[model samples]
Target: MVSAREEILNKLKKAIHPEPEMPDFDAPVYHAIDKSLGQAFKENLEAVNGSVYLCKSEEELVEKLKTVLQNVPEKEVVCSENELQELLTKNGIEHQDYQERQQAIEAGITSCEFLIAHTGSVMGSSALQGARQMLVYPPQHIVIAKKDQLVDYLHTAYDKIQEKYPDQLPSQITLITGPSRTADIEKTLVMGAHGPRELHVFLY
Candidate 1:
């Protein structure tokens, strides 16, 4: 008597084909249509319930950020980067220190390494100078990025990261496509189950 597992393995072994040739290093892993990378990134991210704000300048970026944080108190918003903190302070938008009151943080504003346009993902790494928790623990995650940071695909993003850090890569690299969500219990969808419930990206 032949076991079902053994029979399936034998059939698969007999049907194996020759290994295909490897692609060239410069070969494109993905083909993107002729369109703005920022637009594509915005559209894809918005499709997953994430919000994007396109700012023409730093002043406009600050203005838009103010509107987003209008309802939330300054004490609840956490910002760590010195440059961002200075910008917030200069604009009269006070924020709490990221090191303090971890549990009370309602929103977190952080910089990202790169933004992948195709998947609408933000590439973050510990090399940026903070714990990965800064991205996940907050109920609302706010990312501030530049237009130059946008890339066409994940492969290109990886290549850029490698070029940027030729010595060694960060121990942790995270690609956040959208806010955290789960549909495990009885197929009932829930947001913020494992991480932030809301994701907002401001690009200039």
Candidate 2:
């Protein structure tokens, strides 16, 4: 009186195989990245439809920022950092403070805690100002980062965070690899599904 399901289970039990041994995770698994961390970050970021701009000087950075802002509407752009706001104002670039205009924000400029080169990711945390909204609310995200902020691996980034905040750590940490996208609906890729459709990283 063995039913079809019981017969199938008995046959599967007879053919079951032993579990394989797990490899040593402490040992280095990935190949060592030959290029500089900055280069690796740029290449990996670009591979996921993200844009990277390397600026050599402050003037160049401002100019590049201005160029990017030109495509976005004047009032639709939001910046929360006081330093970045000052820079934008100094350059005659019109932008609203995120607090001032939370509605219809087309773009947002933010600073990240660390940049992971191996995965081309930006590590942000609730501890950082404007990280929660400036990152996900806007249609376009512009991250200002320096070459020194680049880390070779995610673990190294975490170690650095621990060192930086010895007493209190951020409540939430976010790792953004590329533009927010998903292929959930019938496997059709859709950008800006859950967050910013465009991610731009300006590295100096």
lDDT of each: 0.89, 0.90
lDDT of 2 by residue, 1-204 (tens): 999999999999999998988988899966688998888999999999999998898789889988888878899989999888887788888889988884689989988899999989999988777878888999999999888888999999999999988999998889999999999999999999999999999999
Candidate 1 C-alpha lDDT tens digits along 114-150: 9999988999998764548878988999999999899
Residue 99 of model 2, lDDT score: 80
Clashes of each: 0, 0
How high is the lDDT of residue 15 in model 2?
96
Candidate 2 stretches with Cα past 4 Å from truth are 1-26
Show the lowest summed lDDT stretch of 10 residues, model 2. Answer: 98-107
Q: Give, for candidate 1, the lowest lDDT window spanning 10 residues.
A: 94-103
Residue pairs in clash, model 2: none
How good is model 1 by TM-score? 0.84
Backbone clashes (count) for model 1: 0
